[model samples]
Target: MQPTKRFDAIIVGARCAGAAAAMLMARQGMRVLALERGAYGSDTLSTHALMRGAVLLLARWGVLQRLVEAGTPAIRRVTFHYGAEAIPVDLSPGDGVDALYAPRRALLDSALVDAAWEAGAEIRHHHTVTALRHDQTGRVAGVVALDEAGREHAIAADLVVGADGAGSAVARLAGANVQEEAGHAATCLFGYFRGLPDTGTHWHYAPGAGAGRIPTNAGRHVVFVSVPQARFKAELRGDRLAALRRMLREDFPDLAETLGDARPDGELLAFAGRKGFLRQAAGPGWALIGDAGYFKDPITAHGITDALRDAALLADVATEGTPAAFVRFATRRDDLSLPLFRVTDEIAGYAWTLEEAKALHLKLNGAMKREFAALTAEVVS
Candidate 1:
């Protein structure tokens, strides 16, 4: 059925990136439609740690307060443990941010969706985009979607955005090229635990495995253990939780000890494959944001921040629908993303000795400094 309604933009995926883009464009008084394949306020797989950059963007979007109100605590320090040595880095919060946060995805994504609605974006949950609608000249016109009732809707828009995730349907429909990819390296298992004793985030790294403890809401901490693919396969053969316990005890005894009194709040979630890809960000009347356009291994815990940053960047130029604007957006996204992508790929490989890990850690810090410096320079220019 041909729909009578059209929007300035139709964004697929109502999660962090899509909602942020919708909110930004609607703030400019553009009519926007956001579609999600899942229910509103539901959760997805995430480490749930918010870096300073993401926190800054949330504050700018006026949604950080909502997350804080949702019971997310402030994280002030990040500690990296390499065997007996502990390196702690204190985060200096300025501007509107007092500290970092790792809110549950339910809280964080729901807040962003609310912000999008408040900005006048129409959001439809449980609606999946099945195909892209194209013009005779071969430009993307919009999307064909399926609602909860299994009814088909022909939603037309000036631009279509694929924020659906790494395996993005919009990208497939738009024929976006995979500019680069870092193949799978490691796997991760994570869960929330009650009685975890910390307000800050901690990371312990060993030769082929690593663990992260990040404090989140409701006095629960999100803990994850990452191992090389080989170890992950050998260990996760049967009884997954028991396998995780064994991995932690054998490779990360200190982290295992820290969880002695804590019990898991739910089943442990496993992510056995990790890859990073950079796809074409914009082409014709279609553009991509978040994971659809760029993805990095989660070992660096930069996914959320990168999504937020690119949403803002893409929103600034995408509404125009000009080829020049799309190229500009793609350029800026690459400039901001490539450095961290390289660093994350290296770290996610999990192929380093203790001394090598320490060296790479320092290198990562340097790369972060350079990235921020470039961003600052861009703002000045």
Candidate 2:
């Protein structure tokens, strides 16, 4: 690709959203350029539990077949826990969509990006977008990024996408509204553990606390412990494990075993990663997808799955929209993403309540259980 040359789209942030959008657009015969501020998979702090719905996208991209061959764990059941006991809920990948897997995002991110290249998207890593260059009419035109040498380079495109995430520059440029309406997200932190059972997954819910322990490809697992964000103290952030243990034992006792003997590999996963929900997905000549557009509680581990579906929809927009696709893409995102955001917020909030917490166990109705599992499965495959 030539410098200052125009492309069908210029995407910022090459992780999940940008990478998927780039590949999807490229595969659709669009000249796509993806820019990443960080090295492909280095310095990332994610639990890497690729959801079942995301697995479907990888399968469609043929990477799932490769992952299976690579020894990544394929999970087929979910384990729900309250107190000391856990129950496994069986779900099939009928219609060819299996359960879920944890491929170590550090490793899996590279695979997705590489697939983008195979599909013909030009990936430019370590290239951070400094600013968005818009036309006089306030239409997004491209981005100006700084390279390793500190030189300024401009990459122009018809559509400018901001997948930069959380603190999105493109979103700021487009005047996208973030949900400031008392998010009240539960506090959470998770990491990979090497000795947990992988035969089935686990969901341990307790009053104002809970943990989701997922079995990976090997004997490895990733455990997520969520608590009320209000309890997080300035000092607790200084000691992640101690803080984590408190949330586990005091808040949710159901996850004791999974939480016990689990030593963290690093300091902490995220001290304040209450998910962000974007208000828009596209504009006149700009678009946002995946986390750039909407995010749900990773308590369900829906980040990557959101990226997959957003990619599919954006790909269609890139092709059929033939310039008008941006409108339809944004509209579709506006229509589909809000309901998900509202419901997940309710679900996350309930986990922080003792009343709802008690009902998460055997008392949970068939409707709640079915909807819960079905939604998680949908986000994954």
TM-score of 1: 0.96
Against the true structure, candidate 2 reaches a TM-score of 0.86
Number of the top-ranking candidate, with lDDT as the measure: 1
lDDT of 2 at 198: 62
User: Candidate 1 on 224-290: residue-level lDDT in tens?
Assistant: 8998788787888767678777878887888888888466876888997758899999898898999
Best by TM-score: 1
List the candidate 1 regions with Cα displacement exceeding 4 Å: 370-381
**Candidate 2, residues 206-309: lDDT per residue as tens digits?**
66555777765456677677766665544265677776776777756656555577675566675464655655677777777766667666555566766766
